[model samples]
Target: MKSKIFCDNTAALMAAVREGAEGATIEIAAGVFELEATLELKARMTLKGAGIGKTILTHVAGWKPSTKSLPDPEMRLDGLDTDAYLIRLKRDTAGITISDMTLLGPQLHGAIFAWFPTSLHLHHLRIKETLWSGLRTFGMQKAKIHDCEFVDAGGRWDSGQPGVKGGITGGGIFAIWMSDCEIYDNRFVRTRTGPAQEFYGIKVRQGTRCRVHHNTIETNFSMEFPFENDEDNEIDHNVCHGTISIPKYAGGVVPKSGRTFHIHHNWMKDSYALEFVRNGVEIDHNLFDFDVKQDHGNLISAFGNVAAKGPASFHNNLVSNPGRGVIWINEVFNNLEIRNNHIVTRTTTTPRTEGLFGFNPGSDFTSIAIKDNLVECQGLARPLLRAPESYAAIVENNKLTNVSDAKKLTNAKANRPVGLENPLAFRCGAHEEFTVSGWKVRPTKK
Candidate 1:
């Protein structure tokens, strides 16, 4: 075997990358490399560092950025643009692997960014303190990002930057128009700087056939893939301190396989867990545990002007201390199956008087089923199903404790639930999720 090419300094590393052959392995030694401009990567290259935190890459002191504005691939944003990045790959580049490095920044832009990379692999990276996202890519295919630590990796758009209409821009990983990807074993965290209005763990727009599992996200809005025709996306085995949001009305229709997203087996520590009005989703076998004293909202809510297009199901889950209620819908919802879940509410300062499930007017009761759920309100006497007379027929086989008027739990005042009107504004910065009308915008280019 040939001897490995090692670069001990920034000059040697830049020279090796500029002169190295394709498919060459370049090892970076343990030191801080402050770059003046973005490090452009080539195809079929491997850039490995000594180890996490040992090989640090950052910007040079008082580095000035180039004013570049690229066109948005999704056509929703005004323009795709950025000022700085530690490393960047040209479009359509393939087989690029980067591992075991730290990208430190309180700088202008992201750590690693690209567009239309056919294949990209990243692992064991410590990315922190960037103004923009830790990683941002567009139209990537067959990518794998795992075992990365993102600490305060995004804060660029949370502040009021001029010309940015939407306040929520950056995140830990923001990939758009991606397919066939696996993002697992990652940890996203924010420091004690304060709460942020818009900073997500992972936001995948127009994602297909993606699996995001085995990750721990501590941000308020953990993961979001909203209304971009996302199909065959599986989100499971994760721990979220806040909400796991997949905005309602995904792609406006279900895929031919009859599902849009399958979410299961997550440990949710907050009461405001799910946000959905999407068609063809099944959530099961998870734990939604919340402390009653914490700032809380409904367990599941769908806020929109329209109903779902296809069927959905929620079953076999365990919920504790459901703060406001469970399965609250602001608009008409049909063909939803809720069964085999155990939900219990403890003693709280503000008791929930309504039942766990609430629907808006014009819901089809014949198609919705609520059965086999064991609901126990610790001391408060609440109804099992609190809705109009139409909801009286669908309640079946549920074991209730401390329930008032279990047989006829109908209420005329249950038509329009409060706080459900602004469904798009539930979380801190949810306006950005629906700002572009993403369901109607489909990119013709790959």
Candidate 2:
């Protein structure tokens, strides 16, 4: 059941897809195909184009998306408007590949919407300027979306719209209930401003065993996996100008393989690098480089009555010019270990005398360990620990410069993280001509 069609116009393209058998390959020619309605993707088919920017697909002139809010059976949400998408996968579609075209949008929802697709592959496509999101999915498995560009891809999160935090907010790639997916080597950028200016780069809910790496995202919230039982997720080797947010106890019960999430080896330039607490997570071998002039936010912060189930650890990180100090836990947390890091702080407008680490007095200090750290503060003296005096017993073998009578001070060398080089340095975006490594601190591999 294999067939091939070469089409240039909308009618030919639509007829080719509708009539073509399974395992068909439709190669769209170099022209602008104005879509009259949603293009349904068939199973085991390939939608090919001449090239990006050479072949374009967009909505018809004066066409508008339906304002109806329809229920999505895949996500179990009554918020999505299916009439807003240009291309959609057929129910229970599998082994579909869409590549080498521009899905231009300022459309209502997004460019491509799918549900319950298996082994879907998307590459070398530019999804730009969508009102909701560039790509939206539900229950996608073993999908690979790489080398794509999402430029100004999402906005429009008004109240009661069913998004992040009940606000209809979307992102460049918003997928709910995804598993075994790999999203890498993509660039998510916001170039222009309008009502479509607020969203995340990659937003996932209940994602399991997903690997997100080698991306250069410039959105305000680069990556978010929040408020779900997301497990066995790996985030590493990327360049993020915004926050890598995984808060609200997103890590569920640790699997027998150990650790719900493994986050490491990423270059972070934002002051608010990471968000709240979780259990059975290991964060190591990362660079948290924040400029002194940026807004004040902690590198790691948690607040409110967070019933944290612990055994989370952060070690071997290099932090520079922390705006409001590191690791501020406002509530009682247990089984957190912070060790073998180097932090350097300079004189800033904010309080310079605050402790580098602060925890609630009611926390189980016996389970917490802050050891083998090297802190160097220029000009003023800063306290090592700001909690109760009992915390002093846990703060052992730290080298705090210019702090008088530091308890258990040691002359041993700090265990700095090796191979802290930026992986995406000197690499530009795949489609666009944007330089990724324009930061002040660019580390090359030695």
State every prediction's TM-score relative to the real structure: 0.86, 0.88
Clashing pairs for predicted structure model 2, backbone only: none
Question: Which one is best on lDDT?
Answer: 2
lDDT (Cα) of model 1: 0.73
> Candidate 1: which stretches are off by over 4 Å?
1-4, 64-78, 156-166, 195-198, 390-393, 409-446
lDDT of 1 by residue, 1-446 (tens): 32357999998888877787767789999999988777777888889999999999898888744323321233343465544778887667999889999998765467888778877999989998776578888888999988889888874433345555433546789888989999888888887444442468997777888888878788878887876677888987777887877775532678898888898767777888988787888987776778878635888877887766558888877778887788787877788888777777776667656677888667778788777676778877776666665464466667777777665743223232221111111111111111111112122222
lDDT of 2 by residue, 232-313 (tens): 8998777788888777552356677677788876777888888877677888777778887773878887765756757788
lDDT of 2: 0.76
lDDT of 1 at 291: 85
Q: Score residue 189 of candidate 2 by CA lDDT.
A: 93
The TM-score obtained by model 1 is 0.86
